[model samples]
Target: MQVITSESVFSGHPDKVCDQISDTILDAILEQDKKARVAVETAIKDDFVFIFGEVTTTAKVDYKEVAINKLKEIGYDEPFNVLEKISKQSPDIALGVDSTESHEQGAGDQGIMFGYACNETKELMPLPIMLANQISKEMDNARKEKYSHIFGPDGKCQVSVEYEKGKPKKVKTIVVSAQTKSWINRELYEDIIINEVLTKVLDDKAIREAEILINPTGEFVIGGPYADSGLTGRKIIVDTYGGYAKHGGGAFSGKDVSKVDRSGAYYARYVAKAVVRANLADRCEVQLGYVIGISNPVSIHINTFNTGVISDEAIQGLVSKIFDFRPSMIRKELLLDEVKYQDLAKYGHCGREDLNVAWESVDLKAKQLRKLYEETKRASQVL
Candidate 1:
């Protein structure tokens, strides 16, 4: 039996906590100064929290208050030390992004971004990642509600799915780990996780005969930053396709849309989803490369993974026709100024049906691709 695995962390997870803190600060800046340029990173170890990065904005951001509030929001109210080390954007870098010879908006930095989609799920996301994210979400919700007294905030879940001939058949195994209150018994902790969390996302058919493991280490009373250090961008895999797709190694949180690492990747997803939505391919991965101070991407790649209805080359042309890879154009298409990056920090930056994000909209572009594809097929048949 062929099997694939994916894993996700809850909001209270140390790395995710840092991600949220970074994005929350970005959100705060954008709310006041939409044109702000930000590239912030957060790190947590024990009781020390450090917020460091560059900022070019006039927004009044109380770094300490924002960090403390974010920790409290995540249910970590213990006393902690907060540090801030931020500066204005480098003049040399700003010259290119702010005023280029081409007069087009340049990328925030030089990097590569990747986006992918598949027909495995309605949202066009891989099966294992979707299931893993759902399981993690369930845990986060339960911990914030009546179960708060029974379970701590930090938690994660991993899902393994068995596939028959490349199509998922059933879940094979599920592993979950979460911090529990010291007073909670082991049996009760496991019971709460299974019943209140896992079962909520999995049906009897999925869980039946499946190997379920919970807190294998036993008595996970010590977790969060106190147990392990965390830094922003550390959960890049969990924040996107759960390692189901290739990542450009650029993170989404703690930066403005001007950063190609965030916007370029988001735009790539937008185009890839359009291709799958239009039935041009069963699965598609889009890769984009950008150079700092350049509006247009240096390279654009489309891979259909042997599942394209038309040739990959033909699909590539169609994508170019329907979408623009210029940094300024992408920002306009995805309405980057209006998005709440903090909301995207949880669950993932992609495959989000819960949030009405701009990149997730593909109906119009899908229609355009479908129309053009039918014409292209007819012409080829005649040839």
Candidate 2:
């Protein structure tokens, strides 16, 4: 059987905890000064959290309190040490991003950003990651409310989907491990995760049957940062497609929109989703390259994975017209400067439907692509 696996962790997971703290600080800074140039990273370990990165914001922020409050919000009430070593954005790097001769705002750094979309899931995301993320969110809700007594704030869910002829057929197995206050009955815990979390999250059509395992170690009383250290950008795979597509190797969290790594990735998603939503392709992936000190992308690439109704070349031409990959244009189109990123620190960043994330919107671009595809098709037939 052909099987693909993907996993997602709760917001209280060590890495995610760091992600939220970093983004929380970002949101605070943005709320005050929309033009803040912040690129904060966090590292969390047992009883301590370290915050370090470059900041060039005029806004006044209490870094330590931001870290402590974010940890507390994630249900960790312990007294942990907080360290800060943040500095201003380097002049060398700033020289590129600051407006200059020919461009409005140059890229924050030189890097490539990738975006992908598929019809395998309603969110246009790959089935394995979507299922994994949904289950993680479900379990997180249970921990917050009904099952708080049994489940701790830290947990992870993994789904192994069996594919038949390149299409997802059924779930092969599901593995879930949750942190708890004490060792509970294995059977009961397993049953709750299967019935309450997995069953509710997975659509019946997506998974006919599967093996479910919970807390394989038989206990998980120790978890969160106390169990392991977590650093920002470490969970890039989880933050994106769960290895279903190629990543440009850039992390999204803890960075401002000026960082092409964040904004460029978001813009690429906007473009890819537009293609899928326009019905130009059943799946699409967009890749963009930006160089420091350039307002426009150095290169843009698109692949329909042989699923495009129109030719991939035509789609590429159309995408260029519909979307702008320039760092300044991306910031303007997505309103990135005003976005509150803390809400996107968990579950997954790409297919978020609960928040007012602008990247998820594709109506305007979809219509434009659809119209162009039809026009091109008719013109080609006449030829």
Candidate 3:
């Protein structure tokens, strides 16, 4: 048996909190200015939430108000005392990203982004990551439902799955560390958390038999930003493919669609999903590269783990024929500037079929890809 490990962070976890705050600001700005160039970064330590990044837009917005309101919405209250401690973005980075020409729009900063897909889950996401995300979402719902006294805004979940011959067989272990107000005692907290939260969230029999660890280090009374320091772009793995694929090291939060790092990654996933849904491959991964000041991708690479009926190069040809990887072309195709990303900041971004994110739409492209795959397969057989 082979073991695979995957992890997820709760919305109130310091880094995730920072991510949500940054994207929330981005959404607000984009709502006002569809073409707004936003590259907001956020940091949280103790009671304070500090935001810094670049923004080039004509819309007038109250940054502080946006910060406070987002905090309140995330379940932090005035009595919690986390709201009064928020800050603004830096102007230096703003100068570079605030540009008129679409091509001249420098990356808010240099880094890489990754997109991945697999046949493990219905969503084409890796099994460990899919389970981890489901657990995190369950944690949020538990908090909303007040099911567990010991569960709070900040939490982390990790799942290790055992595989047989590259196929996932069973869950090996499940770990959850959640924060709570001091109202509950340790033993009682453990009971409610494990029995109600963990058990209820992972009701699936496959996960129920796994080793369960709840707050392994014990007391979590001090959690959230108060206990740790958080910065934007810190949760990139959590943002996209969940370390299941190679990342370009580019962060997504705060940057506008003009920046290929964010927009291009979305487009790559869009293409990858199409390939998998069309039965071109049981698993597929797509890589898209862009050079600065260029509209077209430097290169596009596809890997199908040998499950593809056609060679990867042939798949690439079909992709090149079918999809546009240019930055401007991607922005228009995916409707990047139009979608509100703030909601995506909290949940796992990729598997959201309900959100109507442009990348999630495979109806049109899937058919095209299916036809291309059939044509390529027939040609290969004849050869």
lDDT of 1: 0.90
Best prediction by lDDT: 1
How accurate locally is residue 225 in candidate 2, as Cα lDDT from 0 to 100?
A: 91
Candidate 2: minimum summed lDDT over ten consecutive residues — where? Answer: 202-211
In candidate 2 the C-alpha lDDT for residue 215 amounts to: 82
The residue ranges of model 1 lying beyond 4 angstroms of the native Cα positions read: 99-102
- Per-residue lDDT of candidate 2, residues 112-137 (tens digit): 99999988987889999988898899
Q: RMSD, each candidate, Å?
A: 1.3, 1.5, 3.5
Cα TM-score of candidate 1: 0.97
lDDT per residue (tens digit) for residues 1-383 in model 1 = 79899999988899999999999999999899988999999999999999999999989989889889999999998998999999998988887787556587899899999999999998999989898888888888888877899888898889998999778898899999888989988888788877777778878776767899998887688999988899999999988888889999998899998899999999999999999999999999999999999888899999999999878988999888889988788888888888888888888889997888988988899999999989888898999
lDDT of 2: 0.88
Rank order by TM-score, top first?
1, 2, 3
Q: What is the lDDT of candidate 3?
A: 0.76
* Span of ten consecutive residues with least summed lDDT in model 1: 95-104
C-alpha positional error of residue 245 in candidate 1 after TM-score superposition, expressed in Å: 1.3
Best TM-score among the predictions, by candidate number? 1
Better of 1 and 2 by lDDT: 1
Evaluated at residue 72, the lDDT of candidate 3 is 75
Q: What is the TM-score of each candidate against the true structure?
A: 0.97, 0.96, 0.89
44-74: candidate 3 lDDT, tens digit per residue? 7776777776677777777677777877777
